[model samples]
Target: MSDISPTGLGLRHSLSLTAGTPVLTLTGIRPAEGIRPGDRLVARSGAVAVLAAETSTLPQAEMVAIGASTLAHGQPDETLLVPADQPLLLRGARAELLYGQSAVVLPARRLLDGQLTRLLRREDVELVTLTFAAPAAIYAGELHPVTRPEPLALTV
Candidate 1:
């Protein structure tokens, strides 16, 4: 299959495991799920991707760049968390890959200047990850989701 997106953007057609309940990745200093109970809240996004846990389920040809999870998704020891009240910036991101499977977080301003996929390819990398410890948006030109958030109290 060709890696080129027919529209030069991206094709959105995956079913969210949440049964089409659209979600926003909470961006910034967030922990794995379960840190805060019932805090399954996610940041809203005009940008989202239909994702499957495995690459084989969703064709790689469809993705310009991929982040192969820094944390084990289903690992027994891994815990997940979400923030109820978080400050969100609905923008895109450009992930600077670090030494190993880790990711280097950069300000989104540095990312907004160019298309994320094309930028990464230009930078000579394919594995771009969005840090959940900051405001990271992934839309058409960007990749999938990851998030973080500054501490905020839950709102009623």
Candidate 2:
């Protein structure tokens, strides 16, 4: 999948994906905001051109919606889907998970607040750091010895 940067563009014009395609379909009140077809959309996933069609149907629904899921070797095992059109959030200090004997860790950051954090925490979350930015320390309070000392001569 391609990645797109969310830069310029009005909030009402946020991008939406249809059937996992890069093409964006404008919905909600955005169309009333003068966001016509053929306009460009700046999405978190990437930029996409608006389709020349308006959807009068309701927003599509997903059977299983989770925030994030970890897969191994491109195999789908664990899946976390998030329903609704908003973001998720996770609280606490840190989050950790062990899937198929593999560990998945997510550090807490302040920017994770609101929807992002809530959505994550709502699902199968392990640890939460609860900070806007990662700790300034090298290991975030993880203790480790600097160096081993050499033996001294005691017979002198």
Candidate 3:
């Protein structure tokens, strides 16, 4: 697949996995500004999320670059929390991988970057994950996902 996506710039789909491999899932939440419980969240172009548990459905490809629809706005003090021990029910954009025997579940709380580095660096790294839902006006390419991101180093 082409990494030069209009939505995902600089993100390279170099992970050697089948089209339908289960890699990651929506699990937990991290502290961020302007985000609250029920506030719509979505992953930016290159942001990566770590899965906490395994699933029998959902595809792997969908886990690579996840995007979601608007979330139900919550009270200003309300916070959204995802358990580090299960999968989250996210709406908008489909997931290709299901957590299962063949699924690629990294260590609990471990984060996989846009290039899948945290996953490649170590198989047992637990990542702290969060789900971000964007407003209908915000779309991919307009926002950056990863915080401390390493550019994808592709060997052509």
Candidate 4:
């Protein structure tokens, strides 16, 4: 959390994005989303999310594969899993779910599941923001990005 600065990564050099779904929702929660009248999945502020892949097209489109049941591994439709304490990538960004739960808006549409998406970038990787809001309604926390350690060097 310390390493993540207030300033997010730069996207000026990016070219395009692929194999991901960007999502955002202000309201509305369908039963398929997996939020029953008693489900309590809301948290405080969100954590710093990791973004190593690149993306483009949608302005502030985040490539996160959002879903409800982590048990079910597949596409994100109707159900969206709000990442707790995960980095919130801006549009055209992606989230790897680092730690801590920040304020989320909770996209009613499919979560997009960007974490699982591996986009083709103009560069090595790109970062995006993923907003989550409980069906109740929460404010944006203005969180930071997930910083990965330097590439590992293997030698003989």
Highest lDDT model number = 4
lDDT of 1: 0.26
lDDT of 3: 0.26
Report the number of clashing residue pairs per model.
Answer: 16, 31, 24, 40
Worst 10 residues of 4 by lDDT: 134-143
Q: In model 1, which regions exceed 4 Å deviation? A: 1-102, 114-142, 154-156
Candidate 3 lDDT over 1-156, as tens digits, reads 423435454432211111222222233342232223343334433333321112222222122322222122221122222122223232222122333233232321232333321122222222332232211111212222222222344568
2 or 4, greater by TM-score: 2
Q: Given candidate 1, what's the lDDT at residue 69?
A: 26
Model-by-model lDDT, in order?
Answer: 0.26, 0.25, 0.26, 0.27
By lDDT: ranked, best first: 4, 3, 1, 2
TM-score of 3: 0.16
Best by TM-score: 2
Which of 1 and 4 is ahead in TM-score? Answer: 1
Candidate 4 per-residue lDDT over residues 1-156, each given as its tens digit:
222223542221111212222222223322212222232322233321222223323433333333333312322333332323233332222223422333222322233434433222233223332222211121122221222222222347
Off by over 4 Å in 2: 1-34, 58-156
Q: Each prediction's TM-score against the native? A: 0.19, 0.20, 0.16, 0.18
- TM-score-based ranking, best first? 2, 1, 4, 3
